[model samples]
Target chain A: MSRREAPLNRVVMALSLVATATWLALPLASVAPNRIVPGTAHTATDLLGWPLALLACLPLVALMALSRRLDRVRCHLALALVLLLLMALPGWLAIASQWLVDPELPQARLGIGAAWWLSLFWLSLMLIELRSRLALVGWRAALLPVVVATAWWLQGAWLGSLALGQELDGRRGDFLEAVVDHLLLVGGAVGASLVLGALIALAMRQSPRVERLGFAVLNFLQTIPSLALFGLLLAPLAWLAARFDWLSAIGVSGIGWAPAFLALLGYSLLPMVRNTHVALSEVDPGVLEAARGMGMGRGQVFRQVRLPLALPVVIEGVRITTVQAIGLTAVAALIGAGGLGSFIFQGLGQAAMDLVLLGALPILAMALVADALLGALARRLDHRRLASPGGAP
Target chain B: MSGRQVNAWAAPLLWLSLLLLLALGGDWLEPLLRWSEPDARRVLYPQADLLTLLVRHVQVVAIASGLAVVIGVGAAILVTRPGGRDFLPLVAQFASMGQTFPPVAVLALAVPVLGFGTWPIIVALLLYGLLPIVRNTLAGLEGVDPAVQEAARGMGMGGAQRLWQVELPLAAPVILAGIRTSVTVNIATAALGATVGASNLGAPIIAGIVNNNTAYILQGALMIGLLALVVDSVFARLLPARQ
Candidate 1:
């Protein structure tokens, strides 16, 4: 490496260090009652382990920068080294912060801390080394989930201090005061969507008479805006209430979780139902025929052969639905469904960036986690199918 | 083969019948029977006719989708370049992130920066619409037979010319499918414009929610759903048969 290149390497590391430090310090400096990172809780930065994490980044960042100066393709190998260092930094910092800070102040659990740091380091390495071709068999497969999980976990740990556990009156942690309130709203909507979607798919598959109707219904549902669905549900909810006194109490204040959940479910039905049908149809015809030939009943063949073969694709559809649901659920907050969306909308109203992050971070975490978990499940199912009794049929 | 074809034709009709039964609840057979109260008409304003509401919705979706097509195609092209393949997945992943989040959140986030109404919704719709178009475009281009590409190159076609004349035409069917998906999703998502106070079909639905009016909700829902079906069917018919 040239002498000039060495100096530039130093500058990049210096810049990253400064950025990390400023990121750490600025939030601390502006400690407000309802800040994105609440002032009272212990963060990854507060642990004794945190400083080691910062120190750990130096070598990797240095290697990354210095390696860039070399034209030899072998320099790309430095990324593996840098990746290891990045992984080590966060845990070191988290541990250090834990050691140095007050024990009583809700610090991140060790598992969470390690996972959090490991992800950050890996993701950073990936981002920096994006231009290079660094392929590892199992590692590339493992890389994305680890990064997403750690990123989300850290966001949770940070927000946990700011919002989670703290008791705020009138307005809850930044969005609507009730976390469960939002969870139920979003959960019910999404859950109902799954059920309805499955039903629609099944119904459409079973009878051709209703296939077009199912398609039409799904197509229609996909077209109406989530906001419009919520609005549409409101009237039905209200009508049910007006007609029956007991129903009214439970149903339509038109501003609560019921309409929101129903609307989300309605919007979700399209992908779920349509994907289910397509996935089922895509099942290998030979496998299904064999199942039928084996004296398996129609129901048995469907449950064992068709569903198993279609499992991966169907789950993929669900994954799409869930991710879409998470976002749509946020809109539910507008009708009082109460998840992190409440914080975003509230922030918009109040013009508070902190509040927006406070809510948006959690929803984002929920999405990342849901996607990761579902992806893992999908992989497992894929493996099982590939390793079927017949062997890679 | 003939029996299977008959079954195939029969199966779709059977499914359609079942769904219609579920939707109408035997109202076809028992026309005299009234299972529920009659729904009221959707509130039609002097300024906002049905045609007007539809026109506005179409305009917003078209503009947003048009923008998305450009961005998606550009991103796909950029990522497919020799150097970009390594990082293309990451870019695609981030673009998917934009889709995964609620547009309402985007609308809310944009409200302060971009201010209220259709523009924020438009931006959000475009952002949300990017993933499918880009992903499909990349897949469609990649899926083109390499032999054809090689022959074109051998015939002295440059990269640009090959892409335009050969690959793009081959990819057009898949690309159109992607565009169709984006447009459909955008049309539905555009209804979210009502919250930030944009004028579209969401107008009646939002007003109905506020006023506890089922008629208004049904009107909008029914219309929007019908429109989606018609458009999807139309496009499905338009697509060329696979060879």
Candidate 2:
């Protein structure tokens, strides 16, 4: 197609142009003399000088220009440019740290500014757009984030003066513990809900009344806010703990993991049961009939046929519940349920922005990772079913 | 309206009145709440009255949800149009991706950039709330059968007319469902704002947590839960039928 006939990839172009504008206009980084003091913001032009700053805009401009007509070659080039921009982001932060933080003052910190963050965000979006446009899937699609993450990881030592880095440095042990707690809580909730949800879904399948009442209760439980649920559970659980010495000994208190787990499990069940029910019910009856025609027993058909077909959808439910649980688990921190959320609440209490970032970023990463991994697993199972002979088309 | 229609409205109205009654006359429940905290001088939240907190909570959620609907639906509409179609995939992807970022984390992140207070809470809620609205709007608009669009075109309806009259009306149910989810989520999230210094219904809960007072926590939880139920019931009634 001629350039005029070929539609411009407006998404990438718009993203790049906005990124370019923001990168110049907003502060690139802020520098504080010490941890307690507020930072002074410095724009790209202020740090790199006008010429160098304008020069730095080269990749974004190229992305915008290349998107004018996105043929395979130009699209590849644009994708490369996007990846290069992402990888360079950490390098830029390292450079900013070197320039802004005083070597003499170990207490000084370099904070990431609005422009750097906006550029990172917009560029990631551009990468997503390019990846979709290019039809990259599976591992090919996963390559970009992995590479960028590796680049950031390798440059961590150089970012010692970065505020987020400094905060993490101080709380390395706490950070790891928080991550572990966050994962355990999320896992415990999702796992318990999955097993319980399957039971409920199975019972619902057996009886219409159970189906109606089960759904009603789960839905009502879902409508209550997480915090309120946690708060509501506090009194009762505390009363129970007081009443039973064993319960307190076992850590079933009004606060902490007990209520948090209960609340998370409660919130998680609706999605899990709904998905499991739908997945089981929606399995093609013809396949089951065919299984029976082959002299397969009910247990055999369920294990070898129905369960495999339902697996993907059930996994999908798990994905949703897991992601939701990850988020809610953060709120559980308020009840002394130690997790990354404690860092968030603690950071907020102390007015420590970097400390908050220390908590928030990992939670964000955990959610995204859980979503991608579960999504890929579901798709793989689905693809396998479609590929297998006599599987649902 | 028919009796059934009145019945449909009754749940929300009852919840709303109960919510208002509780907020306005919480002092009446002081005797009841005192049972939870036998020794404390104050059983009711002492700093701000429940009514004021309830209003502020509603105000925050209203503003956030309102802005989310406008911007989100507008963006969804824009990307679905022929002129803006190139952005549809990216917009859709972004919306779903945005949902993965937890609300509390988003709230925490907002504090650094927007600083403390109601605006950060509002911004966090708005941004977080936008995801569902955008996603559902896109699904709703796109799910409007092409045949229907062609039919509208056959009847000589213009683009804008078809959108406002046919497409939007047809998509209203799904879009309304999205708004309902968005508003419900925001009500819960807005309560988290109390930690960051924006006093709403969450203030009492936070106060309760700090002072280790179950009465304060219960009062706050009650009001928030009631507010959520009232708003949710109204949305439930507004929705055409449960999916």
Candidate 3:
């Protein structure tokens, strides 16, 4: 807080510019016969490339000029423009894939090359910088353009004919179903873990033996590979379902969501339990004493004092657990649970990278959103904690 | 575990047994899993060599976790320095960003560029493993008592000497906790490798998924589960025993 100490925003700004410049001159797409075939690299200058690319960089140029100061609504505008332009680039490549094929090269496949993905990374970072520069206050402001852009993309404007879109169209129903299943699986697992993990933490707080035994079990459970956990559950679940008619009647089969759900629940427990324990333990003892001095009973003190104080950390645990669960559930597809991992394994089997992206991108977006929303909430909670009734802000 | 005095040799002995199992237990264990085919014949895994797969799995986890530790701890040390203090959030966010993409996704993306097999999985595991080590390293170093550090400084130690002789030793256990986490997580996540053609313990699971054979799944899952348990226990005992 003493001073800026150093000013290197310009360096980052310059690096962004340099990377984009490099990207513009490089091949952004490759036209191939199929997923595995090596496609010839097609550069940006080939079709509407330089002009479009330059327009995209206009905001970045403005950013570099005002690098010494982090302000400029125009720069934010330009970054959004750049993002839109970059998104369109892929569409154009998709179009070009259809139109630009040689007479002999039938079934031309258009796929993003190294430069395309790299530029996406760079522009995403630049977009972050612009958001920070604009002082956009929360996830809402940051998400506005992204939501708009994603909505626009969903219209099947240019990306529709792309290999990825075509795959989505083919299995539109299945894809939509998978999306719903993925959300439900994550929601259920995280929700259950929050309750179970907290109860475990509470037990740990009441007894040292419980704490010791709980962490050991949770850690061991966590370390088990996701697939292994699912696999391990198979025989027992099948046996239980067979031995008891009611269990089978309730749909506790060996595969699908049953094992997947249980595995994710187990995977999410360690973070949930660990965070709850640490948060509960770290509450200042003096605060508890003060509550007691004010005539609060043990239960009252815990409900009001301890729980409120520990809420932020508990939420943090939820955030980590949710994000981690989102990832782990993708692997749950192997057990016939049929989430995003189904698309991934299929894509891998088909040697179709775009199909993989189709599955992976949504999972990535989900995790990011979960992390962002919960992270912002945690920060707000900490800020509120600072402004607690008796605390100095 | 918190209150009991751990026998120093307990973990090592457990690991020795696990290693012996990994080396020799597969043939004996094969008979436990009986897969029924359409012809009504029972069999073992169609294409699995348990020892080979376990070794490959260990190799991938070791390399990936090692890289993650070096980078995570190195970045933590750098950012905690006066000159690098401002970068703490940036580095932390960057590492976090790497994790939001699932390891399976990373493998899928990496395969096209890095080619098939071990390299892609290693890259994916490295990315997946980075955040825990970095975060824990930050926690460990920051948790070092300031007054004790000041005392060390008062003894006329330079910055490097102070960090190496004082800060690091004090932070060692916590940093090890981070490595333990990164390693364990990567071991689990590295199973994504089998999906991408990197032969490992997941190979059987993937094959089982393909063939609808629970026996193959068990063979793979059992080995990985046991492997994870053994590795995890070693990490559990990493903290200095107090007896």
Best by TM-score: 2
- Badly placed stretches (over 4 Å) of model 2 are A1-6, A389-393, B1-5, B46-48, B241-243
- Each candidate: RMSD: 10.2, 2.1, 4.7
On DockQ, the leading prediction is 2
What is the Cα-based lDDT of residue A68 in candidate 1?
Answer: 46
Would you list the rank order by DockQ, best first?
Answer: 2, 3, 1
The digit string of per-residue lDDT tens for model 2 on A1-393 reads 555555688898899989999999999999998776889999999999999999999988888889898878899999999999999898888888888888999899999999999999999899989898889989988878899999889888888899888898888898899899999999999999999999999999999999999999998788676777887788789989999999999989988999999999999999999999999999888888988898888888888888899999999999999988988998899999999999988888888888888888888889999999999899999999988945522
Q: How close is every model to the real structure, measured as TM-score?
A: 0.69, 0.96, 0.84
Best by lDDT: 2
Clashing residue pairs in candidate 3 (N, C-alpha, C atoms within 3 angstroms): none
Better of 1 and 2 by DockQ: 2
Q: Per-residue alpha-carbon lDDT of model 1 for A240-261, expressed as tens digits?
A: 7778887666655556776776
Cα lDDT, all candidates: 0.63, 0.88, 0.77
Q: Which residue pairs clash within candidate 2?
A: none
lDDT of 1 at B31: 29
Per-residue lDDT of model 1, residues B66-166, tens digit only: 99999898888777766456447665766766776667666765664466678988998998899889888898889989999899989999878988999
TM-score of 1: 0.69
Error of 1 at B238 (Å): 6.3
- List, residue by residue over A123-192, the lDDT tens digit for candidate 3: 6666665555556766656575566467556646655345566667778999999999999999999999
User: What's the true lDDT of residue A74 in model 3?
Assistant: 47
